[model samples]
Target: MLTRRTTHTTLALAASLSLAGALAGCAAEAEDSAATPPQPTTDASSSGAGDGSTDTLAGDAGTEYSDGTYTAEGSYQSPAGQENITLEVTLAGGTVTEVSLTSDATNPSSKQYQGQFISALEGAVVGKNLDEISIDKLAGSSLTSIGFTEALDSIKSEARA
Candidate 1:
């Protein structure tokens, strides 16, 4: 009877450990597959490794930017295919006063991520200088930033005085 009880205890412990391991694995997979979008924060230190241009426009174009809103279509390659986004920014005294993004992604996944990026864009860029507005990732969307950066570069050219 003692030996039988010991065996039953060992079997119960093993089954419990297996169930716990399976649960952990499922949790990990869920976290990786659909990560919760990051909330927009007030921290100003989340700038990405930008394209290395300062307040001055690229290629000796100088830093004098026209005070107005500019729009441009930015494109980037994604796993599904090429994706594009329309980006608009309002500038006042070389500072970003407003920002917006329109996602043109046809792929559902791409569209979802772009929507996440768009949702977080104003917090990332509004009130920043034109050259200081680059972002590598926001709202758990990294690839969308590439398209945003491209669009921002075009806007800078359009806004250059």
Candidate 2:
């Protein structure tokens, strides 16, 4: 009678352990199913200017427009002095191929300083996209640089219209 009772208890313990192991396996699978899938990465190349068109003084490149010249005028006043500037832009195939600057400075001191500023402008912006062009101020000619950029911006705005 005692041997039969001990065998029954051992059988019950083995059954309980099997059940616990099965429950643990099911719990792990449930946790895995609850997890989220990885998301795809975003593309950075398509971020801005969706049309893929480049900005130029004439219009977008490869377009046809009148051959006549367009003129834009602007002025800048700073602590140094006032600068009056005009830009003559030539357009071909709807692109700005050339830019010319005319400046009026009566003061000798202003003229000397403005010359360096104008030279910097001519080098930085000629043959470049008007929309993308930006000016970094020269070390000692910050005011003149501001004036030059203002004039260039006016030219860009007029050309876009």
Candidate 3:
């Protein structure tokens, strides 16, 4: 009888440990997902503004733009859903002197990719001619570039001299 009790107790303890381990693992996974969600992957072939539409650029060749700051909001459909970003850009001599991007992404994956895009935006755009900027991908976030290009198109129209 004592051996039977001991065996039952051992099995109960093993089951309890397994349950506890599974719960702990689930909590850890939830925490990890909340803290560093996965970035939304984008296909490279369809990621860029490859339509060759130059009319959205800063007017025309040797076009002089009014040196000032402009803001615009752009939206794109991601795998998560609709995501939007707002850009504030300062242009001088048709060159992007300073730029800032604010994201309105509710989905975790979209937010992660937008954050990645923001982290790498300035280095890629700053001090570059606004007309020459053609961002295909930055910080492994290709979808965000579509919104950025849309915003930039608006800025170009608003900042044209």
Candidate 4:
């Protein structure tokens, strides 16, 4: 019942439609990919924002270690009340690499004091031998040193290799 001319026409139309459909799909994918913005990647060691100072993780400053990370807690009584502090330290090649300190100071004045202590600690503890670290007063926060020492003592024990 079909004529040769009709059959040839139908085949040609079908092939053209299929090709067009595939090209459209590819064009849509390309558009979607172009519309998305590329995300920026950051290096861990790279410094950014605020005076080019690198903000790195803390390290423990006392006695040689097997080169790893360690944490210890410290506390002491101030005029305000009992103050709690936590320290995380990093050791590399048997030397203190960094020291990170956190405090549980609730009082407003204590908060200020703790901030000062931490700032002072960077200069005093960083790159020093853990066994040689004996900070007496940091940024006028002399009272907290006892607690800090206590925590260091524990860190030494825990980090013993």
**Reference-based lDDT, each prediction:** 0.84, 0.63, 0.87, 0.82
lDDT of 4 by residue, 1-161 (tens): 88999999999999999999999999999999899977755454566654655543234343346788889999998899999999888987666788889998989998998899998887888887777788888889897887898898888778776
lDDT of 2 at 151: 64
lDDT of 3 by residue, 20-107 (tens): 9999999999998999978755444553565643332233456668999999999888998888999999988888899999997889
- The lDDT leader among the candidates is 3
Q: Among all windows of ten consecutive residues in candidate 3, which has the lowest summed lDDT?
A: 52-61
Candidate 2: stretches off by over 4 Å: 1-68, 92-95, 138-140
Per-prediction TM-score, please? 0.62, 0.48, 0.63, 0.59
Candidate No. with top TM-score: 3
Q: How many residue pairs clash in each candidate?
A: 0, 0, 0, 12
User: Candidate 2 lDDT, tens digit per residue, 30-108?
Assistant: 8887795666454555557666643332333333345446776666775457777676767554445776767787777
Residue 32, model 2: Cα distance from true site in angstroms: 33
TM-score of model 4 (CA atoms): 0.59
After best superposition, candidate 2 residue 86: deviation in angstroms? 1.6
The weakest ten consecutive residues by lDDT in model 1 span 53-62
TM-score of 2: 0.48
Candidate 3: regions farther than 4 A off:
1-61
- Rank candidates, lDDT, best first: 3, 1, 4, 2
**TM-score, structure 1 vs. true:** 0.62
